[model samples]
Target: MGNRILIVDDAAFMRMMIKDILTKNGYEVVAEAADGQQAVELFKEHAPDLVTMDITMPEMDGITALKEIKTIKSDAKVIMCSAMGQQAMVIDAIQAGAKDFIVKPFQADRVLEAISKAIG
Candidate 1:
């Protein structure tokens, strides 16, 4: 089966950007979430092969939601997304069990690379 990805971002544009990247590269987009809370809910509902999560969001930030998702399934592979200079949050996300991270204004190749690294 193709790898399933759940995308999370507060901005609809950002979510679309990610979806465009993943779909063209043969990854199945299982769902999209506008915030981390929805991300966790989608994770439960879809049980996707991977997740691309945004760090800055309303209604539960990425790190907090990452922790919650980890509680549900420790083996869940999550790759975090952040804007430049969000180093502390990125570190916290890794500690919370994220498999990897991507910096924003994303590069399609880099995003795919991270997803491949996480899922494979």
Candidate 2:
């Protein structure tokens, strides 16, 4: 993927791991944020081609941030990252405006496939 991407996760290691996956596969990580509030701000500033947002974060959670970002850019492409068994939250995210979602303990192939489906 050639698009500029943003990764938002409260866990530093999670962010790092995803970044590594994207960068190693030729995606550009334009920004990374530790909280949902920061993710919103960064989205406004960068308007990256895509966003990978974690569901649980400080200050604001991913669903709220997803809603806020949708308010900012109606066509914003966001993919929620959630841990296993968060089905209700996942449904809420999809309802709110997330274009797609991926589960944690990230798989490199799954990430790429989701990004491709979202951006394509």
Candidate 3:
């Protein structure tokens, strides 16, 4: 089996887009979450090899979720996703334990590169 992944995004289309990219690249999406709270719950439930998390969300926001996930498993691999101008949050995410990050209007190659670099 390929590396398992959990995707967290508030927008349904965004989640679908990421899921498509991952599945096409031979990654297995074990679960999907619409908010950071769900992301945390799903992370615990799935224990995926890696996670793709959105920086902003309704319930908890990615940074908090990332920290929570880290507390659950210190070595958990997470990659934050942000829109065009969220560089500050991206830095915070890295400090909070995200392995890397990807920008929106998602580029297939960049997304794949970040995931591969994070998990491999």
Candidate 4:
């Protein structure tokens, strides 16, 4: 929870909720993005210790951005966020190098657990 984190989600509310969870838990939210394209750009600029990425997004998707970020920093620690039941997408994300994943309607404990596992 001490690591710097970048949050990527198309919904402003989702981003805000995540930021709230992370900040309250003593994590630094270095940057936030509304889409995968922006997420990739911000990743380069911030070089955050971790990234929380949303699967379905505009301009680009989390998987694509994850791949792009991996190209930039092969060891980038990215934790994907997805809605429930997107099994194929979750598998794809894992295969593409996501450190972990969290399902939406984000539970504070679950979020922290994923972050802990990813950053540790």
Candidate 5:
């Protein structure tokens, strides 16, 4: 099977967009979460190979969720997604253990590249 992945994004459109890119590239989307809290819960449930996490969310935010996921599985691979100009949050995500990050208005190649680098 292709590398399993979990996608987290508050915006349904964004989630769909990433899911589309991943599915088309032969990645298996194990599950999806609309908020960081859900992301954490799904992470525990699915244990996907990698996660594409949005930086901002309603309940927990991506950085906090990333830390929580790290505590659950220290070697968990996560990639933070951010809109342009969220550099501070992106840096925080990296420090919190994200494997890589992709900017918003998502580019297919960049998204695929980050996922490949993180899990393969």
Candidate 6:
């Protein structure tokens, strides 16, 4: 995973965990945001190759951020991160143009796989 990535999650621990995995595997952690609003701002500033976005967040939600990012760059690649039982919200994310999704408690393999599949 050599791509530059943006990690967005309200939880600092989650962001750290993701950054750890991504960096260890050779991806550049371009930026991290705690909420959708910040995520959008960072997206504009950094224009990372990929974004891993948590679904439920304060100030704005992942779906809304995804939409806003898409508006900014139509070909943006985003992968939604959500806990189990968020089928409806996941569907909404897909409809909103998320390239893929990863259920949380973030498995390293699955996370890497989704990013690989999406960026490819």
Q: Is candidate 1 or candidate 5 better by lDDT?
A: 5
Residue 14 local lDDT, model 5: 100
Q: Residue 57 of candidate 2: its Cα lDDT? A: 89
Tell me the lDDT of model 6 at 108. 98
Tens-digit lDDT string for candidate 2 (28-63):
999999999999999999999899999988899999
| Candidate no. 1 TM-score | 0.97
Leading candidate by lDDT: 6
Model 3 scores worst on lDDT over the 10 consecutive residues at 1-10
Alpha-carbon shift of residue 18 in model 6 (angstroms): 0.7
Stronger candidate by lDDT (2 vs 5) = 5
Deviation from native of the Cα of residue 43 in model 1, angstroms: 0.9
Model 2 stretches with alpha carbons more than 4 Å out: none
Question: Candidate 3's residue-wise lDDT over 26-64, tens digit each?
Answer: 999999999999999998898999999999999899999
Clashes of 1: 0
What is the Cα-based lDDT of residue 46 in candidate 3? 88
Q: Please say which candidate is ahead in TM-score: 2 or 5.
A: 5
Model 4 residue pairs with clashes: none
- Across 1-120, the per-residue lDDT of candidate 1 in tens digits comes to 639989999999999999999889888999999998999999999998888899999999999888988998989899999999999999999988999999989999899899888878
Worst 10 residues of 1 by lDDT: 1-10
Report every candidate's CA lDDT.
0.92, 0.95, 0.94, 0.96, 0.95, 0.96
Backbone clashes counted, model 4: 0
Model 4: which ten-residue window has the lowest total lDDT? Answer: 1-10
> What's the C-alpha lDDT at position 49 in model 6?
96
Off by over 4 Å in 3: none
